[model samples]
Target chain A: MTEPPFRRVVVIGAGLMGTSVALALRRFGVEVLLEDADPGNLRVAVSLGAGVPVTPGDAPRAEQADLVVVGVPPAALGTVIADALARFPSAVVTDLGSVKAAALADTRAHAPAGAGLDRYVGGHPMAGSEQSGPLAARADLFDGRAWAVTPHADSRPDAVAAVERLARTCGALPVQLSPGEHDEAVALVSHLPQVASTVVAGLLTTAAEGHLVLAGQGLRDVTRIAGGDPDLWTQILSANAEPVARLLHEAADNLHRVAHTLEKRDAAEAGLADLRNSLERGATGVRRLPGKHGAQPEAFSAVPVLLPDQPGELARLFADVGAAGVNIEDVRIDHSPNTPAGLVELWVHQDTVPALLEALAHHGWDVHG
Target chain B: MTEPPFRRVVVIGAGLMGTSVALALRRFGVEVLLEDADPGNLRVAVSLGAGVPVTPGDAPRAEQADLVVVGVPPAALGTVIADALARFPSAVVTDLGSVKAAALADTRAHAPAGAGLDRYVGGHPMAGSEQSGPLAARADLFDGRAWAVTPHADSRPDAVAAVERLARTCGALPVQLSPGEHDEAVALVSHLPQVASTVVAGLLTTAAEGHLVLAGQGLRDVTRIAGGDPDLWTQILSANAEPVARLLHEAADNLHRVAHTLEKRDAAEAGLADLRNSLERGATGVRRLPGKHGAQPEAFSAVPVLLPDQPGELARLFADVGAAGVNIEDVRIDHSPNTPAGLVELWVHQDTVPALLEALAHHGWDVHG
Candidate 1:
């Protein structure tokens, strides 16, 4: 096997991201030392074979570490990162935080004068779950995900390279951006949608039980991310307050425009064109999202098949598709409890539709248009 | 095996909903006559075995129909329903439209004096897809879904029963509500989310391409519904203008409040509590949605297992899962192209988790928490 990216790495927080990083580094045969304020978290990380706990007696080992990954909560990111730099004077420092600018500013504020400020870079792996903590960590969590590596102006080239290497070692593609640019990008892609989803879901609290019972897949998808931990989100939002607030205000303005146009539509039916334009713009925007693994979504065609509700039906269907030598890009099962037949939509490359259709026909699977 | 609900049914406008309804009725040996202003849609529906095309030569069959289902665009619902009542005076007329109050009011205005207005009822099926037209239709589209039956004050009991029966014949649960109440309910559950999603996605048009590369599943889910046809949505929103505008205003106010709180947090950290409260409310509201087929979402647990990226691996996994005798409630596959292993999240009843874990371990599948 190739030599490990880092000779010795010390991870200062044994939470989800930190533990996952340690576990990923261990896969490369790199020596890892883990530490956390909470003994339970440290114990769990160690037991998961992520790394050996950096006990008091392991101080010398930590001092000799070449890289220190600080994976604390947003509120504590800067202070902990600054402390890591002071404790391990020669090691390059990095953090896993959602918001980059705030963390960089805080680190600069907390670091003593003449400290190695050039050693720090900010990284955010664009991957996570609604769940948190050590048990939720996985070595492959970042696979094929974009990891934003944000470097400050004062950051050294070698430190930025080390952070990029760290992202790659975790099975992620590293995209380099300045701290401010990274913050601005996430404000649009991540924070804006998060707040918009929250506001939509927040309105659901007033919905009658009968009304909510009418909710379908659309509402569920739009609000799924709203169920994230409130405490965590509060910290995240607070840390990136300026940019997120700007986007929220802009969104509010658009929503108000729609509402005003709708009210006018009720009065004279004059704003139908405006409503259509807004909806059209939305349609155009949604089509711009990159599909799984960076492919265009339209490049795949869905062939929905009706599967009988019985054991091994899905297995049999998949087996037939596999026999046809067609790769399934995605599968969506519309399972309805009241019916004996479920619709499964198999998405494959547009070119593979003919072969897949033949396979379904040969297997006697009912295919829907 | 049993008598079909309606002896002869006429479906006008062979679009997605109409074609799906005809296909569903055909499953029960019911005779259906399909009609559409567009010859292509009628031909496709007829060729799918949904029904026989109602050409000019089939006037006798159309007149003898016991039920008339108007499945035209929202703008034409009232005129078509009135025309159907005039053409087949004895037939009970119902419509598949998103907004109930507007359709009922328009029909009331268009019907001639003493035109048997009691035979008309408005229906809004709480199921749809982003795709439209006959080709996207499916026989089981409404399986285990709610179908709202809205009866105005003048409707007769038999007519109401006929509409409810229609709902059942299409494999949906019939929900009874007044025209006004159904409008209000859907304004909250459907139209509100649609507009919210549209607004969020509309902003994406202004985002930088690099920023969009940072998008993840959350943005995708929140914007998926925004991809629905703009013309169709314009009509749906226009018809439900009053209720939808009211809810949109409320949502806009809430978004503005959150934005203000976030802005305040940046200055003094004073409104963090307010922000948290909003997020908390959103979390609580999202949890209120009923799971698949009305089951509580919390009743299921997700078991994520890593599968090797190879053809037939999915079939093998499903076969193993079937051998364990646990019914998989849902399956979500996170297939990253760059990875050698993909993660499949199988949702099952919480009580079956231990059994599933045992089966997975025995099969040497790598399970992730």
Candidate 2:
């Protein structure tokens, strides 16, 4: 009836991910000790009921913990990890850092606990948003997403199992990769896209492209990730610079090739083919993308409607369209600074177009033929 | 009123735009003549009860017509406009072409219908989908988008008015841009981003980078526009090669700059600054995006929940959050691969976060500490 080795856990970061991990551990009836230097975050996490605070001075209670999960900022990763290992010599220690190779590079030598840092595994839950902190955390945040554990040569079998168990408890699928491999993969997926999105967003000059001041759905899509936290992504992209930079240059090369084909007044065959292939690949990539809960979702159909210039016209149109017996799938409105009227486009089920049209026509509307 | 000048309308080219135009004119009690060499599109338009077909051997209905709208492919734009002028010598003739410059250039010589060719004008509606053809035609399509007309120096006042009237009837705002200006604006806003999104999607080799394959909301946003019909976009980009190529080149330049910053290893000041400014711009851009019906949207906040991997978990969480009495303003989900258990993020009205968290915690759920 002895307590199974490592039961209680202490996660050393109270940011969004840390709070989420703490909340998740609570579901499985495990006592989670969530830590952070930020008073605001610690207070938020406590209010959320994720855990009660415990410090280094908590003594045997802290040292006797089976696992210490470090979910601190990437820049503070090494120091925080070293301190945890020293404080809890028998406990397995892990850090959730975006950069694997560098983060885990000093794991063994710095971890003064265990024969080696064998009980110290590395984990990265590839989940995020433009916002951050405990306010952004959730108990079910890690469910069904990739939780990568970049294991080092000196990492202990027990520590790896403990981390994996924690990941499973949080409903994440655990995958293993060497620190280098994980870094390279994320560089392509996460790091490169971040910089690319940023550059795209920055292209709009405050001058004539003052038009950039009024973007549409298309621009947002291409620039969504560009709006992420600068401090966080800086540490990520910088750590994995080699791969991210390589991808950026590769993207530029592709652009150059396409540009030259069109510049030379080539029949557009080569340029079209390049874009065609690229678009198709992107199409497939989008299809492969997971939906709300990580499942592939059906592509939504959008319907464009012409709205009148006067006020209340759009509301009336929507009300009329809704009465036509179809759910509005999505809507897009086009506005022109130079024009007197506006364009209102509605996205409905593909089957509802005719009904919506019939309804508007019945209402004596003057819509597009 | 001289019989309101020309009372009958002729829509040459039975495609979706042409047929939709014909249908909308009926809302105003106008006589419609739908002309098209494509019997299939004509049949669809007729089936939609849009218009009655006009035969080839008929005399110039121009004397009785106020407008003749030509909706033909860009390559054939010049030929169609000239023929419409010849056939409707006394009617104001206009065209629906995606690339205004090419169409204007092609038909520049056939201006001044004065009820003859002097009445000809070049027009383009900022609408259409991957799905094209008369079957996809709907009178509501142009209700709230822009319909640009590039008037030539020789354009008669009556002809321009007629074209502008057509735009208005379609519920579209009439935007008057010089052919060059229209071309450039679209190239920057519409064309460049389409190519970029497709390229990003194309760059994904998720099979190899398994975890990276865990594409989320960001990837979908960036790639949504890439699913456009390649053949159609090909024709569009090529027809407007000069401007599109220029924009693509500009984008390439920006990409290179970002790559260089990353390569310079100045993540702290230079690289990080670049990243942050990009994100800030993106956020600004997103905030500035027009909302439903082109209204300036209020910003909504995302309240992420760490969801369980189980199927019913999301349903349960949502029910609980809803029961907590917070109104949901909007929502989005992101999940990555290699991690079966993932984070479930929810978006809600801004300022409701604290109350919702309190409610969930009050229910004895572990959120965070």
Candidate 3:
């Protein structure tokens, strides 16, 4: 077996991201030393086989590690990165904070002189779940995900390569981008969506009970992210405030314009045209989202099957698909709040739709176009 | 079996809603006469066994029907209801339009002298798919759903009972409210979400390609409703413009406040508090949404299982779940783009979690808390 790129890695946090990285590295037979200020978090990470917990006397071992990964809250990222760099003089360091530019700026402003600045690279792995803590960590958390690596002008090329290798070992695709570019991109795609979802869902709090009874899949889908942990989201949004705030302001303007036009009595034609434009634009945006395997969005024919609300029904349906030897690209379950039956939409490549449909029907599944 | 509440039902407009109603009525052995201005739609509904098409020669038969259900576009709903009331003089009439107040007002203004105004009740079934047309109709479309029934002060009590009976026969729960109250309720629960989703998705059209590569479930969920049919949405929005516009305006004010606070660098503490409040409100709103069987939201523990991307894997998992003898309250499949494994979260009652987990583990499934 080849030597692992991050052989002696010290992870200075035992949160979900830190433990996940440790687990991924350990899977590749790398030696990982886990550290966290919280004893309980460290214990949980160690018990999960994420890594060996760093003891009080293991300072020398941590200093001698080949790489140190900082995975703390955004507010504490700079101090943690600086400390990691100062203590682990011989090791290169990287961070997995969501907001890149702010963390990089913080590290630069606070790092002690001769702290090996060139050895540090900024990384933000665009992967997470609403769930948190070491218990939620998975070795495959970063698999097939985009790990944004932001290297400064003065950074050593070897240091950047080490982080790239770390991402690769975690089964992630490394994408090179500047800190500003990274922040801007994520602000539009991630932060803005979170804010918008929260605002929309907030309105529901005042909704009448009768109103909520009329709720459908559209309302559920649009507000799913509002269930995220508020404390963590607040930290994330605060760290990337400027860009997120700007995008949200623009959205607010659009909302006001649409509302005004809708309320107008004489501008019915104009109001409709405006609403249609927004809807069409939204359609175009969703269409541009990359489909499975990072491919351009292509229309996948959905063959919806009505499945009984019984145990093993979904399994039976999948078994039928397996018997047909067709690959199921994606599947979605649409169940009404109190309904016993669900419409399972199996999304497949268009060319294979006919064969799959026939096979499913032959298996006595209630298939619908 | 006893005769259906309405033995002879005339369904106007052979679209998804109209056809689905006809199908449900027919299941109860009712004679249904389907009418649509479009010959092709009428043909499809008839071929689907939804109802017998209403021919020009069958005008007298349609007029003499026990009940007439007007299911036309919002723009044409008022005129259609009036026409149905005029033709079917003895029969009670109701409409299944999304917006009730406008349709009721239009009917009141346009119905000819001696028209059975007291027999007319307005309804809006709180069930639909993004898909439209007769081909999209399902026999159980309204089954186990809330069907809003708006009866005016002058509406006859017997007429109200007939509409309630119609809802019950179609397997929907009739929720009685004023037309104004119904419009206001839906504006908050349904219309606001649609507008917010559309606006947020519209912002993505201008996003960099790099931005979309990081898109995850949150982004997908928040934008799902943006894929709805633009034309139909325009009509729905226009019909209930006042209530929808007012609600959206309030949402816009909230957005502005959040944005302003987030953009203020000097007010970090206040900004975070504001952001947290929004998120907290969102959480409260989601908690109020009814769980399965129309019960108050109950916390269910999710047992996540890692399943291979192969076809039969889900089937095997479901089979294992069945063997556990536990009812799965809900299931969510979280698949990363291009990943060969997916995390399937099985939500069951908190009390059933331990047994379900132990059984799955015994079956060699990779179960996680």
Predicted model with the maximum TM-score: 1
lDDT value, candidate 3, whole model: 0.82
How much DockQ does model 3 earn?
Answer: 0.31
Q: Which candidate gets the maximum lDDT versus the true structure?
A: 1
Clashing pairs in 3: A315-B315
Best by DockQ: 1
The CAPRI quality class of candidate 1 comes to: acceptable
- List TM-score per model, in order: 0.82, 0.69, 0.79
Task: Give model 1's DockQ, 2 decimals.
Answer: 0.32
lDDT of 3 by residue, A1-369 (tens): 987767699998989999999989988889999988876567557756778877778877777899999999888999999888888888889999989998988998889778889999999888887667775778899998889999988789999999999899999989899899899998888888887888888888888756788776778778877877788888888888889888988999888988887888456587789878877887777767775633733656788887654433555677789889888876665435653245678888888888998898798888754
lDDT by residue (B16-46, candidate 2, tens digit) is: 7887887777666677878788665665566
How do these models rank on lDDT, best leading? 1, 3, 2
Question: Chain B in candidate 2 has what TM-score?
Answer: 0.71
iRMS of candidate 3, Å: 8.3
Give the clash total for candidate 3.
1
Better of 2 and 3 by TM-score: 3
lDDT of 3 by residue, B1-369 (tens): 786678799999989899999889988889999889876577557756777877789887777898999989898988889888888888889989999999998998899777888889998888887667876777899988889999998888888888999998888989999999999989987889888888888999888767777776778788877877788888899889999889888888888887888878465577678788888888777766764633633657788887653423554676678888988876655435543345668888888988997898798888754
Every model's DockQ: 0.32, 0.19, 0.31
Task: Give per-residue CA lDDT, model 1, range B1-369, as digits (tens).
Answer: 788889999999899999999989999989999889976566557756778877788897789999999999999998999999999999999999998888988888899989989999888778888878876788899998889999999999999999999999899989999988888888888898899899989989888758887787789899999989999999999889888998888888888898889877756655998999999999888887877634667789999887664433555677788999998887664435753345668899999999999999999898975
What digit string (tens of lDDT, one per residue) describes model 1 on residues A1-369? 788899999998998899999989989999999889986567556756788877789898889999999999999999999999999999999999999999999999999987899999899999877667776778899987889999998999999999999999999989998888888888888888888888889988898758777777889889988988898899998888888888888888888899899888856545888899999999988988776634666789999887664433555677789999999887654435653345668999999999999999998999975
